[model samples]
Target: MKKKIVALTAIAVLSVGTAAQAAASSVHTVQSGDTLWSISKDNNVSVEELQAWNELDSTLIYPSQDLKVEDKVETYVVVKGDSLYKIATKHNISVDDLMNWNNISSDLIFPGEEFVLQGTKASTTNKTAQKATAPVSAPASAPVQKAPSAPVAVKAPASSTAGKEMTVTATAYTAYCAGCSGTTATGIDLRANPNQKVIAVDPSVIPLGSRVWVEGYGEAIAGDTGGAIKGNIIDLFMENKQDALNWGRQTVTIKILD
Candidate 1:
């Protein structure tokens, strides 16, 4: 009887230990080139859940970092052009209610930040997934023909990056042009650095804020957009008209960096 009791106790302890080990295995190690969306998909978890568990401020992650893949919680992603008031209004809740729920002391919120939204988590998950897998837009056409001194911009050549790229013509524009506002589609103010290496790309072709290398243009950000800069077309920002003219119309390779 004594031997049997000891054996049973040992079995109970072993089972509990195994359960704990199984729980710990829920963690996932981050790998190179892993985006939050990709990580969530692989783990069968949602991006909001990952953000909540890890308290992540942005979607950015580094290799060797560990992330929680289980224990999901309800959450919402704040997209671009969102304000507390705007979000509250869209959710049919009051701004004060939002602040209370999020434990936020101010009205400030940023893109990629997750919040615990009340009600209908399923809807939130679907919406988040849609955004994560949204297709890249086709490259824009050549920038509008401006003065002779303006740089001719063209679309960068295609590469094997996740986001597709296409060769298109390009034109150069100055942020300080007459009656022009220097704001980018991604909210970068070109007036702050007129000489900054930035390109106005259609948000669908190249995501805003993506770091890209323009052939002969060095490294530049796909930050701004132009009315004529649709479908494989891009407008490179130049410091002056003379520099723009010097760069008029050239085929170049665009490589999206990881």
Candidate 2:
């Protein structure tokens, strides 16, 4: 009876050890050219969740990073000329959110970097999807004409229920034309900077948290405004004097989309 008791105890210990091992070894395979964005899209997971799961500093990933969780992660093959930013936009998510999801600290992603996306594919990418698709007003034959010049003396939009003050959080990187003394930046240069956080918002018209779909630029939440950008005015950031001049002031209609 003593021997049988000892044997049973040993078996119990072994079973517990097996269970612990299983809990610790939820591994995921790496595929060719897999990026965190693609994997997140396929698996229906946010890039943020993936990052938390793996404790990544940036979006950088390598082949065959073993995931310890039993949750399902989707995978995608990387194509040549792919970028993390573009991939994030394509999936309708912010770059920062994607980075956080994958526990990544850098923007570098190579082919076959496996990542786990959380949730059903549809819900994860819906927020970043473009809301306004109205064709930009331009000349009949010219290649996208400039917006109409700002009214000489800008008139404020109709006043709503006594200007209520509300707090808004940063949903995405918003553009600003704060530097009025320099040339404006082109589209490519405008969207490249990561440090720029200045947002050009029209206060009375767009209340806080109201998502504003800019004409030339993509979607941006109405988060903040500059001293000079009060009322109907907007100040978009420019790289240099040349860019500002090139993208001269135009009448851009701010569509309040959600």
Candidate 3:
């Protein structure tokens, strides 16, 4: 009778221990001293459950072997006013770097769109890239502030009217010319606003006061016109003569905004 009583107590204890192990069982890497049973007990999982998750025929495991932990994923939903600049600013990263990170083509983004803030399962499947590091624009405590003296990022509110969309041969030019008034058609002082993005387009092709997106270049103000700029030809104003020469000529997509 005493033996039977002890047997019942042992069964109850074993049942409780199994439940505890099952509760904590998810996925864990086999550390140096880790065995299949120890891993299952620590994570509150069964050895068979771990085997099933890892598709292992036996309990044999090795260090650094990745096992399924959780199916949870991380993502971000785009809000109404979320621009690349704003989102990147929030994440403390650069606009160009963000574009590269997400493989984003243009600044255009819609609400409710999802982006992977963290890595996916495939990225973690390999032991090499255990965690993906998001680029840090700066330290977390300090807010990212642009220098007032530096040129703007060129992402301005575009005009309402998208008058035309075309492929044009764009050539760069400097403010200093042989016999030129160092001023734009719209009277923007380039000598003063040297870094300000300004482009020269034929008034007939793209009217003055128009905003445009030039491929390979950011947005620019169509505040200038050039004698040579006519029809499909556009003159992109560079800050210096060297810049003009560097961007000799290229066929670029132009989005003509109001």
Candidate 4:
């Protein structure tokens, strides 16, 4: 009976150890020549999963940077003054995922509400499969055009009313900038459409979603905003980082066209 009791105790201890090991978080340290794709492949996880877990805005990673690779279900209770974006940033997850996991269409959330942080593997797999099988085609309503190699000189729509004209200090920016998610404030995917004519401006000065004509950079949609872009400051979007570097900083005239 004593031997049997000792054996049972050992089994119980082993079970607890196994459970703890399964629940432990996994991390991967970036090495030279390491890419998110390679790391995700090696870890049997998707690249999106890695990005969500690490809260990476871009695919860029550096040597010795630690990344969370494990996907574990977590529940978060909303506190006072909590927003979806805030909660998502805090948990290193995407706002879209947060809404999808909780089946909420709107961003509105009340205090004490619970939200799932991680998506189920089966759902992710299904999405991947669906994407793989879907047909790829641009919408006929809005035809796709090849973007110009350089900013082209264009006039604003003749029908639209001209708004305020201001001479602002302008700087260039790219989608690959550090901590940049390649997404604009108005939901323009810069990384996917690098050649899209867009610029960041202070919405108070130049309203967002307005067409603006930059003195030298041609006409672009004022579709983005930045923390540093305040008052008389604007940021031009460039497809190439070298082009952005070449632009540097300059004072330019901009006319907002509605």
Candidate 5:
């Protein structure tokens, strides 16, 4: 009958639609002798990524298990007090990577905006391959001569006044100073992370743990406090005494990014 034919045609269309949806999501079945590292190698992904995508606490797997081999698009929603640097630091990723993943050319990002956390697998694999194939320098038998220090031109990051901006008198200090514990008041270990960008601020003026953009200094975290760092005065952190001395004192503009 015509009615029976119509019902069978509708059922066939629904079955085909379901099959297409399943095929779109790439899933790999775990077989005997399979490991996370081996599966990652076969799929052109990293073992860390495998664990993250599957939300697996460990590398243990059994036969006939299903694993998601496709790259999962992870995203983060910007909050009231969030900056690219802050979010990248929290996620243990670079700010450049974060910006590139989101196709962001500027540092300006608004609250409630969503940003992608990961790039495509091809990009990630290419970066890893480049690192692995990089040429290593041969060890020098003789003492290498030190080059003369040149005046390096530092490029400041793009300016943004998304939050409060203030002109503050800035001074530089090193963590290796005499009698210094190399720890900030906010519990950031400067000695352990000499490259970490941090600045001492008056908690009343710039709240601790705030992401601030300092003029000529780029982005930094307000993670320290000083006895003399009162009012509009801020102390920038440097890795070495020479760098601190070079920075000396300057009047700079600071924007509280978050």
Candidate 6:
């Protein structure tokens, strides 16, 4: 009877070990300032798996957080002033999914939390991109000279190849508030609000934080605008006060820098 009991205990231990190995294809040791998003990106696992395995609540995962690597894992330590968003971007995982996995109740997180890695899948869009069409403008009060044809020799960034070019396009729009940004080439002065942060932009072609030069408007950063600006265009913030007023109707070519 004694021998039989010992044998049963050994079998139970082995079963548990096998189960653990099956559930986690890889294991990651948390370093200082590790977040779930970072771990997921580093490894090829989804954020949901990270949460389900680690049982996290709140989007916050701290340094020294031990995480299961779904596949190949290279351990990384978290740095200071790291936020979940930055980490998610670094790892390429959705912040929402990261939060859900960790059972994170609040955004609150401190340094030194430990966790596992999750990964993101590539995005595939089903809808075809619509080509931009020229909109009819109100009759000008004064006669205006026709601008020269767009230059054929002008080189464009490789990113813009994703969409067809519009003869005329809406570069930016006014956002009265979140979900309230007005559209159209209404001739709002762009220089009125100077030094504003970028609200939105086309991530594929015109990356955020890129400085651009406009033919008519001088130098400006690709900053602030509506959801419609996504894809191949950019939005520039005007200086405050009369800046928006000074922006009159004009056509210009935009050049992006390296």
Score candidate 2 by lDDT. 0.38
Model 4, 116-157: lDDT tens per residue? Answer: 566542122111111222222222332222322222122222
Which stretches of candidate 2 lie above 4 Å from their native place?
A: 1-89, 92-198
The candidate that wins on TM-score is: 5
Candidate 5 regions exceeding 4 Å error are 1-162
Model 5, global lDDT: 0.59
Name the regions of candidate 6 deviating beyond 4 angstroms.
1-193, 196-200, 245-249
Q: How many clashing residue pairs are found in candidate 5?
A: 0
Clashes of each: 25, 40, 8, 0, 0, 38
Give residue 258's lDDT in candidate 5 (0 to 100): 48
lDDT of each residue in 78-127, candidate 5, tens digit only: 54456677777777877767666555555555643545565442122111
What TM-score does prediction 4 earn? 0.39
Tens-digit lDDT track of model 2 for 106-173 = 45554323332432321222122121322122122312212222122211211242122333322122
Candidates ranked by lDDT: 4, 5, 3, 1, 2, 6
Model 1 TM: 0.38
lDDT of 6: 0.37
Model 4 residue pairs with clashes:
none
- lDDT, candidate 1, 182-204, per-residue tens: 66554445677676788877767
> How close is every model to the real structure, measured as TM-score?
0.38, 0.29, 0.41, 0.39, 0.42, 0.27
Spell out the clash pairs found in candidate 3.
21-44, 21-45, 22-44, 24-43, 24-44, 25-43, 25-44, 25-45
Ranking by TM-score: 5, 3, 4, 1, 2, 6
Better of 2 and 5 by TM-score: 5
Candidate 5, residue 243: lDDT: 86
Please give the RMSD to the true structure for each candidate, in Å: 24.0, 22.3, 29.0, 22.2, 21.7, 24.5
- Estimate, for each residue in 1-258, the C-alpha lDDT of model 3 and write its tens digit: 000101000001111122211333344555554455445433433445556778889656676676654232233334334566777666665765545434455555554343433322112111111123232232343243322221112122223334346899999877776665666654455777689788888768776555567887766766677668888888888888998899999998877643
User: What does the lDDT read for residue 194 in candidate 4?
Assistant: 85
lDDT, candidates in the order shown: 0.52, 0.38, 0.53, 0.59, 0.59, 0.37
lDDT of 6 at 16: 12
